[model samples]
Target: MDALDDLDLRVSGCRACPRLVDWREEVARTKRAAFADQTYWGRPVPGFGPPDARLLIIGLAPAAHGGNRTGRMFTGDRSGDVLYQALYDVGLASQPTSVAADDGLELYGVRVTAPVHCAPPENKPTPGERETCRPWLVQELRLLRPTVRAVVVLGAFGWQATLPALAEAGWRVPRPRPAFGHGVRVGIDRSEGSVGGGGPAGLDLFGCFHVSQRNTFTGKLTPAMLREVLSTAARAAGLGK
Candidate 1:
């Protein structure tokens, strides 16, 4: 297991962010039986991929009834179901199902991470919390060296968190990085003080509307669109047939 794997053991009852801790605990009390005996992994969910994973999926934060409750990123949620199906179809996952934490699913060469590890109230994390949670992401990126070639940022928040890391590594992001439509690729280059974002950043950062309830409910993103994005990203990552 990578260092990322141990985050659950380290801080499930994390107190780093007081607001998140209180909110998660509050939910745990009301829905105790629903999550009976299950450890609320309210801590940061680390990246789940091999050291040499080619694609990195960055999400915003954990869901209260989802990742925090199930102890797996994106599990026990609708968004996860869609995301996992697309991932399996793209040949990056070893299993086709991601219904629950113990669904016996596995990723082949991709890892999913959230900008903020803790599940935020109403699924929205404040700016301060996002900032507080970013250091873990940076650490994970550093340990995942020589393997991450591309990143699929799920939303604007995720995109924002990941861009600076790429830029510091010498990947130049085009001004504004344009807008958030899928299948778009803007270049990234390290700015003047970007120590981590230097050299020939082989990572291709793809932006997509988050696989969230809002997008799914509004029909803004379809299953086909998700599959297409996954296919494109996987081919770029050299995982496609």
Candidate 2:
């Protein structure tokens, strides 16, 4: 837990990507009209949840006015509304809403994080930026590897980013990696010489559509759909019903 705390501090101070650094700070400075009176957490956001979590939820990136302003992954965002509510429905989260960092929300047996920690321009991080920020995810997974048995990746971008991070953390990913799609599931084996031992009995990865406004508003991802995936993931992680 101390190590995870240290990693969070390290992540908060990172300025490896010049573009992301400038953009995140600029948004903080300019301020959105609705959030004019609030100060933004204009730095790389850290993963949130218990260190011994068996279920891991991976997202693409933070929303500019959402996490960038609140300092918590998925907080103060429309996407978070859908995601958290579904998590709550499945017994993974204690609450259905996440408004601010200190909103008294708690996750049970689950951790929420993103591939890219900082909020990017247009809600999209460039390929280079993703690669630059990859090490953080790698280190985070390394710390959580022992307990994390089920990973729920939101969107194809998260799926792609997470696979490499898992591999770097010693999980043996299949060659010609499995493609990402809503409800897709892939079983990853741990390397023989890896921390947890290599075998068929390893982590289970699940794919789900991102809880973005575009997806939810257009019915690309519904509340019931997200709950189903999360419930399945919880069971896979041995969290029980």
Candidate 1 Cα errors over 4 Å, as ranges: 6-14, 32-39, 168-179, 189-200
Q: Write the per-residue lDDT of candidate 1 for residues 62-82, one digit (tens) a residue.
A: 788788777778987889988
Candidate 2, residues 1-241, lDDT tens digits: the string is 4988899889999999999999999999998999999999999899999988899999999888999999999999999888999998888889999999999999999999999999999999988899999999999998887789999999998888999988888889998999999999999987777754643238999999999999999999999999999999999998837
RMSD of 1: 2.9
C-alpha positional error of residue 183 in candidate 2 after TM-score superposition, expressed in Å: 0.5
Error of 2 at 45 (Å): 0.6
Give the deviation of candidate 2 from the true structure as CA RMSD: 1.6
TM-score of each: 0.86, 0.96
Candidate 1: count the clashes.
Answer: 16
What is each predicted model's overall lDDT from 0 to 1?
A: 0.73, 0.91
Candidate topping lDDT = 2
Which parts of model 2 are misplaced by more than 4 Å?
195-201
